[model samples]
Target: MNDQRPIVIIVFVFIISAVLLTKLFMIQVLDDSFLKRAERNAIQRVVDHPYRGLVYDRNGKLLVYNNPIFDLMIVPKEFQVKDTTRFLEIFGITKEHLIETYQAARKYSYVKPSTFIKQISTNEFARIQDFLIDYPGLFIMTRSVRSYPEPVAAHALGYIGEISGRQLERDSSGYYVQGDYVGLSGMERYYEDQMRGKKGVKYKMVNVRGVDKGPFKDGEYDTASVAGKNINSSIDMELQKYGEMLMKGKTGSVVAIEPKTGEILSMISAPFYDPNSLTGSDFGKSYTALNRLETKPLFNRPIMATYPPGSIFKIVQSLIGLQEGVLTPETTFACNRSLVACHNHPSPVNLFGAIRNSCNPYYHQAFRQIINQEVSSNTYKDTEIGLDIWREHVMKFGLGGTLGIDMPNEKGGDVPSSKYYDRFYGNGRWKYSTIYSLSIGQGELLVTPVQMANLAAIFANKGYYYTPHLIRAIDGDQSKIPQEYLTKHDVGVDAHHFDMVQDAMVQALFGTAQRALMKDIQIAGKTGTAQNPHGEDHSVFIAFAPKDNPKIAIAVYVENAGWGGRAAASMASLMIEKYLKDSVSRSDLEKYVIEGKFMN
Candidate 1:
């Protein structure tokens, strides 16, 4: 036992010694990784951030471009700070700033390069470049910042900023690192990979003083960065600017679409800030200020703001009725103002006249007939099946959900179903009268401005619509856009059923929206005044031009605006005129819209 114990002790000592010796050899001799790591003390990794993609309007007009900016980078070990006074004067920073900033740089890294002062102007860089060589540890890193020339479509183009720690972790692509800028919203965020391009690495040898010694190994290990692909958007910059002009001083949204292609022509969220304000050195300050405002200038209203679709939704009801065989163009309903009081127009209105006059009682009975049709012996079961069928057909119109537009934070508008009612009112407890408000496009029928424009496109195409999209082409190739955008989505109603609705909508100009009539250019439009619980009623309108072979479909909403005919219908007509005629002949009407007379 004693001999075995001695042997065991010797073996344990030998094992510990062998393990230590193997690790020492691996670190000091067998493996060169440690030596390579130590060699990095003299090597500098200059990160090359690729130039982000340029943005252009459909007509090839430059919308977003890059402007050169300079960052004073430093390697804590290489930075000598020879003349702190000259450094402070050149950078225009105080002495206290230098101390704190330099300390922060060292905390970030003892050997790696870090940004000391960012977004210095070209003149500032030129003044200090000559003296920069004298201070070995300090050098200029050229970077490009986004620039917007037209300052239109601020919400659609989006902005870029430094990557957050959270973003770094979620970046499964491993394309981003600290100090990298990423798309924060809008089209920028949707096509981040294409717009960001591939980041290239260049390994340059630097001396102890942080002076860049030309390419290491004659650029054997260096690679050039590939610039991001340019994006050609569907926006007509001129029309977008005009829409913004008309919407100024108002809180609302507007979206225009090409009915056949579903390409967005203009998307305006009123009370917008200049896209340039969120770029360059002013980004942090400007973003903070805009974010704090109560009106939410940064809030994207075109795709995010949800409101009752209002009377324009009556078009859906009319279509659904015709498809279900519940009503005909000649079908008449008495508008006695008892069931749902509406503006006095005619005593009894047929479906066509009901639509033209925007009568509430017509849809009230028509909607009840839709949900209480003689489908089952049990009325409750019949109502449930009928409403479910109605909702399924409505979903085909791209309502009750997000249209899947290529933008961030697109809200899916609400359209309550049977389950929603079942949850609220319990099993078989709710009836047709309980949900009667839905008849006039009120109650739970909420929609975004983009969705409303899509509804107009559906009407223009008879019974089908293309999912609305902002990107027209990517990588200079139209094929690069998603296949879904190219596909046609049909709303199940027969095409002839749309003929009746289309005829009725055009006749509406003679009744409710007389002011929306465009000279010679035929327009089909619907006006809506949505009830608001918090403030004045919201004005809304949806329209398309040229009647047949329509070029553009549009939706406009004006918050706190009294009636649809006054503000919304007028805006839609002016936009249609500008698109079709290439110039607005109605100078007086254009003046009224641009001056915001209707809003008053």
Candidate 2:
């Protein structure tokens, strides 16, 4: 028994020695994870943020650029301050704030760095840079903030903000970290991949106090950051500024496009804050205040807001009526008030006269013909089939759907299908009479201002349009424009049908939209008064100038402005003249719209 026990002890000793030898082998050569972790403790890893791309207008005028800023970073494990009061005074922060920030950094990591104070201006950083060396754990990390040369096109340019937790979780590329900034909206959000650039990594030797000693291995392990590609937008800056100036003190939107290329010239939503207000250290406060306002200055109305097409839709109706063979140029209808409420106009008018006078009864009767084409024996079934067909035609005109602009969160205005109506009023339960409001573009039919502008472009081109876009080139390469933007979308209407519609639209300017007339440019336009249950009617207008070879096609809407010709027509006229002539001749009309006197 004594001999067996000695043998067992020998075996046990041998087993222990084998385990120790294996562990030493792993520590010495087999595994390097532990060694890498130890290196992290001795060296500091810094992220090299690339410069964001610059934004320029079509004519090579700079619109958006980056301004140098700094973030004060800290490592909680190495942080020490002898004079706490002096430190707070130097950074212009309260003692409580400093403690809170330190606690957050500690919670994030004991050795890794985190942002303590963000978006420090160049002047501020210059004043306190020398004092930063006194604090052992603190260092300056350079960053850039977006700057606008002028306060125009706030919604189009957008702003950047700290990455949210949800965005970080969704980030599949793993490029962004805790303190990274991301584009939140507008073009910034739409073109983030092109505008954010690529981030680089750098290694530096540091002491126990987390101070940057020097570049580790003389930058042998460092990667260079590539700056973002610059963008050349299609917007005409002068026209955009002029449009915004004319839209001040109003509550609505304006959208203008070049008819030949479908490039957006101007997109203005009134009651906008300066883009700078959303930049720098005061972003949170400014955004909060703007968000709480009743007017909703942050709302991108041109692409987001939806309204009934009103009488401007009559032009579309005329084109559809012509294409469907339901009505002809010589078709006449009585100015019958009993059919639908309409303003006083000539009775027994032809198609051209109906458009010129915006005759409600003419469209009401015309819509009935369109929706009761005897496709089914049952009256209800026939109306349903006809409405579905009508919807298909309307959608081709870029109505009731998103136009796919180079912007985010664009709301596709409702072009209610038969299915939509079936859900609302039940299948086979409703007929044309039940949804007659759509006859004059006032029912469930809705459209965004940008879509309205596109419709005008469609008219200017006679039958087709390109998808509207804000970006024309990237890094001076026009070939980089998306294929979809260059692709033409035909409305499927015959070219001859548009000639009659165009003539009617030109006649309309001589009638209801007399204020939109130009002396030498020869304008064609239509005005609308959309019914508003909340307040007064919304004034709306759609127009294109130089009726022969139109340059700019525009749409304007003025909320609670009552008459379309009073405000909307005048604004559209001014925008057209400003784009073609580079100046406006009608000072009285510009003052009338800008001063908010049109409502009175």
Candidate 3:
């Protein structure tokens, strides 16, 4: 019985030892995945943002660059604010700021690091570094902020700001987080991807003190950030600066373009605010001040503000008249001061003479003839082909639609069609006589400063123009304007018709804008004093010079500047001479435009 009892005890002890070993093996091997995940929770991954791209003018002048900025970051779980008062005094912040920052960090997650203070300048960074040792959980990180060197072109270059919540949900590659910056307007918004570089990640092993000890697993997962692509703008810095100077204290816009390439040399929208004002810490206050100003400095008048083309549009009417074969160069029409008289003189004026005199009656007659011919034509009797033809010709010139420029927020000026007329005056009731105002570029015919400038470009090129653009290239690649834009568009008129029209424009310079003419240069231009609904006439001028081999084409509009030849014409001529001849011919004219004050 004693031998049997010893054998039973041995067997029970062996079984108990075997069960303990099996359990130990399961914990070490089978549960390894769970333990590994727990370790990863303690180690956090952080993204490092790369520097934004630089912007340069056509002549290689730096428009925008980056400046180093310091940001104070906090890891809420590790933060121990010892002596809160002293910490506040050192950082030059209130206790509320610290509490708010801590709360934000906690909301993001106690394990994640968050920004507490951002955009500390170099001087502020120097002062903070001296006392950084006192703060354990807080650390300084280096980042880059945009810096405008020229301080002009604010609207064109645009501004960058923090991304909104809506942007994050839509683009969830983690491309943007809570505080990521994005372009808000102009070329910046149009080319965000090229300007914002890719973000890089580093898995860091941080200690309980929030100190980055080293990379987790020796940085096998770290990615290097790519720098953003640089942009080369088509804007000529000198010309842009000069144009802005000319537009000082005025509410207007001036757009200058190279006829052949369609590169915008200068685009000035008056009442402009300094771009540097919207950058850095004072942005909120500065933005409020600008918004409250009576003059809306933020408005981009070149592409956004639509106005009547005025007498400059008479050129289009004349071309259309000649193209439709309703009027010949020798066709004569008389003009008197009477509003009701169609022809008041026995002496007949040719096309060149009529344009030189700006005879409204001649265009009225020609437009009526065109309408009657189209409505009575054999192809489609009663089909209003003349109005359709006119609409087609205008649309071919890039009117009535967006110009597809690189800038954001361009408004397409309205160009009414035959259908629009039909809507206004029931079918077949409204004739060319009912809408005679169209002959003078009034009524519903609206165009922008950019469009007018492009009109001048088309005439200068003898019938075609490239798409006007501000940025010339991205990283040295030329623009992608279509070949059709470079090719001439026949306005259904003979080349000889252009010669007559060109002669008339030249005569206009000799007649009304004679005071603006230079001694050595020949400038072909047209002056327009468009009647305004709000107040006095709006002075406008469109010109291209040397006349023979046109170089710079420009359009200028001055609100309430009175006579087109006096204010807008003088300014346009001065700019043209300054660009082509590199100097002004009339010192009195220059002083008048520079000092002329108009009541807005």
Candidate 4:
């Protein structure tokens, strides 16, 4: 029994020694976590941020570029300020702010680095860089902020900001860190992946004073950052400047598009702030102030604000009426005020004259014929079926749905369908008489300014359009623009029908829209006065030039600006003349629009 016990003890000791030896081998050879931790004590990882992409206009004029800035980073465990008051004064930060920032960094990570002070300008960095070495654990990391040379196109260009928690969670690639800058809106947000480029890193050696001591291990672990690809936009900067000038002191938007390419020439939303105001260290304060304003300067009205089409919708009704065989160009309707309210015009006007005169009763009579096609014995059933078909045709014009423009937060204006009405008034409960308000572009029909511009393009192109887009090329490659923008979308109407409608739109300038006419150039246009329950009627206009081969199509809207012929048409005319002739001959019209006197 004593011999067996000695053998058992020896075996137990052998097993314990083997386990210790294996663990020691693993810690020394296979595992590098402990080694990395020790290395981190002397070597700091510095992020090399890439420069954001540059933006240029169609004319090759520089629009957006980057300016170098510095971020003061902090590693909490290594951070120490011997003179707290001096540190606070040097940074221009309150003591409370310093403590709060440090506490937040510690909560994030004790050993890892975080931004202590963000977006110090080059001049500011030069003034404060000498003092940074006085405090341990603080280092300067160079970064960039966007700079706009011109203050135009703020909404179209957008802005960049620090990565939000929500954005970080949604990032599947895991490319972004907490302090990383990301595109927040507009083109900046839409093309973020292409414009962000790749970030690189370097293992930088530093002493206890937090001063950089050259590359660690001769930069064996360093990577080179690739600069972001540049973007060439389709905007005509001169025209954009002109449109913004015309829209100044007004509460509206203007969107101009080239008819052949669907490239956006200019997009202007009034009451916009300078793009420079939203850059650099003051972005937070500037944004807060802008967001608090009642005018909402940040709102991208061209694609976001929705309005009724008013009389300009009569042109669509005329084309649809011709396609459905419900009315001919020669068909006449009496100027009856009993059907719906309309301004004084010729009685018993034909389709051409109805469009020229914007006769509301003509559309009211035509809408009834289109909706009551005798498809069903029951009048209500016939109306329901007819409305569904009519909606299908209207959607082809890019109404009641998003045009899929390369912008974020675009609102697809409402085009209430049979189901939309059924939810309110039950199925088969509403008839042609109940929904007659839609005949004149009122009721539930709504459209964005960009959509209205596209409608003008459709008329100019004689039945089809391309999706509107702001980007023309990426990094000098034109093919990089989305395929959808290059494709044609036909609106189902025959080309001949558009010709007749085009003639009537030309005549409209001599009829109700005389204010939009130019002496030297032949212009085709339609005016609208949308009913606004909150205020006066909203003035609206859509137009294209040269009568035969159109170059540009534009839509303008001015809130509470009385008649469309007075305010909206004038602005659109000036824009057209400026684009086509490269100069405007109508300074009188320009002065009238710029003075903001049309609201009276």
Candidate 5:
């Protein structure tokens, strides 16, 4: 304003020229910056790994995605980290760590590049990367490591790591080279081929000092990398997060499925870890720590554990009896505790009442009728025939076998066969009474929690079920999933029979599992206090909400809990309420399940 423009311009130019001249002296006299560009160097072909696909929950919440990382790769012969003090200080590592890493890397290869220090976070590398040019033999390579914000689903969304020797040899696609990363489990492992896009190679001309000059052959010899296809999963991240929280301080699993589409809403295995912890340089340390855990956090109990299904199996028994025509709605059995012990409920209950009360003695008599309904010459022969038929019908509900969920090493679960009985009790020696305990869902029958969730799906769908699955679609298209997952699997039982069972399951919430019944949402559920011979009984419960046009079907198992109503059903009720309403109305119950210690 006071005619100072000429003075300001003169001073600005003087200061800029002085700074520029100083910088030119540093680059020209001290070290070469553009000098490497002036001397054309040899082209180094670097393999560029495509960014792994991003994973998002059903509502577009990001579950897993790529984060930029720098791996310090070394060509042992070409790399030299002189000045131990400077090297250690620059990298923020100890002398022993540098030596051990170098030796281990050399064992891999002396000439070829191998990762010396893997998975350095972007922020950490930013601090030292400017000084990396002073070092030789070591070069920074760009990579993407997995990052999880919530750390909710470690088992459901498995992590990625370097391809092992066995994996490399088995790769028939010829896509993997050394130092490639691959999906190891869950949705990652299932859709590996699609999730990991094709790799590209770039040839960059560099000087003898390992400095990049420019693209080799004017970029003619380089192939561009294509990022992986994004996957849209059916998991409700909020529900998954809530389920995981409810299962804290306990040992068990909670799996919820969409009754119509079989899209898994949530699959929670307790003692879970944050997926973020396994991503950085501490991956090996985290793996070893998790491996040593006595709780066996790595063990996926939902799809892997086998336990007697307890009173929940009564639903299967009730259906099998109806299909066999040996038991009817009008059928009554006395709960006199004559054959098995009971906790003093009313006697001579009908089928509906039997299911409502989960009367063990009533199921015992009902199972006996089905097993000994003389279609054959003798009762023994008839019992074997009926038992075989029952098992076949039961298998239709995806029991005693894998539900074919998109997970690796999933257990098919065990359902005792005649051969099983023959080996254990001798073929002809066993009959209905000898194996009467199975009538109450005990003795030799084992089922996975996934299978149990599928059973709830079957009941909700009324005699038919789509396979319970984790994937909804790939790349936002629902058709990308396998055809079998969409196909309806029907149990041989009549659809009308499920109505009675549904009513009974609903009545159970008002009776045995009243704690599980939420206001305004009619939840149909069954309680299972399973016998654990070595210790206390395990708590188990299965339920579906809004009985008509169901949205969520859930199954919960709490090890060493006293009863299903206490832990399993209570937690399940909270989950159902949360999913349907988007917030809980039962804060008191939520606090109990979240804070209470159910097991010793």
Candidate 6:
């Protein structure tokens, strides 16, 4: 009976143990929500930023590079500050700043990391590293700040900044996270992907004391960051520097393009700011200062500003007239001095002489002939048809619209159409006489310095031009032009018309703009004193030299500089000589351009 009782008790105990084992299996294997949360609490995923690409000039000179900067980051969930005062002193931040930063970090998320201090110098970073033992979960992250080697071309190279919220929404490849830098303007903005390299990831293991133990899993899951591809720009650094020097204390733009390749050699927008001003710890303040400057140095005048082409428009008008067979190169017109009457000149001037003298009446006569020509024999007999044809010829030279240059935010200067004339003058009611001022490049005909430079390039190329571009290549590979940009449209003028125009332009240098000629160099240029409705005339000069096998074509506009033969012309000549021959032929001419003073 005693043995039977012992067996019963043992069976009862076994039954109870089985029930507890089943319950443990249900909690451990069937339900895993709590265990997954525990695993997330312990595992930390950190992003490793890739190094940004470097920018080089056409000569492979470094333009933009990166300087290592340290950011003080805090993981609030793991943060344990033993001595707050010591931490603040090491980081060179105030106690109030630390408190505010801590509060902000907490608000972001306890598990998430946030940067409390930014752009601490290398020396400060060393100090922080030595005292890191006093602060747990506070770490130093190495980041890069843009550094400019030459400190010029602020508008061309542009600057990088933190990605905005709007940008994140637009691109969700996780390519950019918080605190990522992005190109904001110029070529930088235009080629963001090529410039911003792929980011890599690395898993790191840390000890309880917040010290990095080593790579997790022997670096098997780690990725090496791919540095951004190197960029080769088309800018001639020396020419760009010289142009900026010529434009010192002036308010205007100068754009020089290689006539053969449509490469922008030098583009200077005056009142320039140092690109170094927009980097490091003082970036925000310096940006604000530049934004508030009176002259608006940040504005890229070459493409952003539009002015009347003035006498430059006469060149296009003459070409259109010749192409339409309305006028020949030997066709003569008499200039009448009387403003109100058409019968003023009996002294007949040929096309060459008329262009050299910048005869307004001759172009007036040519413009009238163009407006009278019909698009087709059976087409509508509207005067706007001829004007439209004239506009088409002008546009073929890359006017009246965006030139599709590689730079960001280029303005397409106004090219009024027949429809626009219809709106202003009523349908078929206006005559070419009503818009005679168009012959002289006035009355709503606007062009930018970039467009002006392109016009000179077209003439230099004798027919066609590559789309003006700033970036020459990325990582040693030449940039491919888009198909739309490769098509060439003619200006409707034959080869003979350009030759005559070139000859006249050369004569203008020797005749009207004689003062602009440099010794031993034959410069073909035209001067323009464009009337400014707001202030004094804007002096402008467009030129290319040594006339045969031209190397550089340029346009310079000096606001309120009076005549184009004065500051604008001299500047153009000096720049041409400096670029083509590597030295100005006349130091006296260089001195004149350097020291020339403008009245209003």
lDDT of each: 0.88, 0.90, 0.79, 0.91, 0.85, 0.80
What TM-score would each prediction reach against the true structure?
Answer: 0.92, 0.93, 0.89, 0.94, 0.90, 0.91
Across 392-460, the per-residue lDDT of candidate 1 in tens digits comes to 988888988889899999998888888888999897888787788988889998889999999999999
Supply the TM-score for candidate 2: 0.93
Rank the candidate models, highest TM-score first.
4, 2, 1, 6, 5, 3
TM-score of 3: 0.89
Model 4 lDDT vs. the true structure? 0.91
For model 2, residues 475-575, the per-residue Cα lDDT tens digits are 99999998989999999899888887888889898888888888888888899999999999999999887888988899999999988888999999988
Q: What's model 3's overall lDDT?
A: 0.79
Q: What lDDT score goes with residue 263 in model 4?
A: 96
Q: Which regions of candidate 3 are displaced past 4 Å?
A: 1-44, 130-133, 172-174, 340-348, 377-385, 479-496, 583-585, 598-600
Could you say which candidate leads in lDDT?
4
Pairs with steric clashes in candidate 5: 79-137, 402-412
List candidate 5 stretches off by more than 4 Å.
1-41, 93-110, 597-600
Model 1 CA deviation exceeding 4 Å by range: 1-41, 82-86
Stretches of candidate 4 off by over 4 Å are 1-38
> Quick one: best TM-score, which candidate?
4
Spell out the clash pairs found in candidate 3.
Answer: none
Residue-by-residue lDDT tens digits, candidate 4, 442-464: 99999999999999999999999
Residue 345 accuracy (lDDT) in model 5: 67
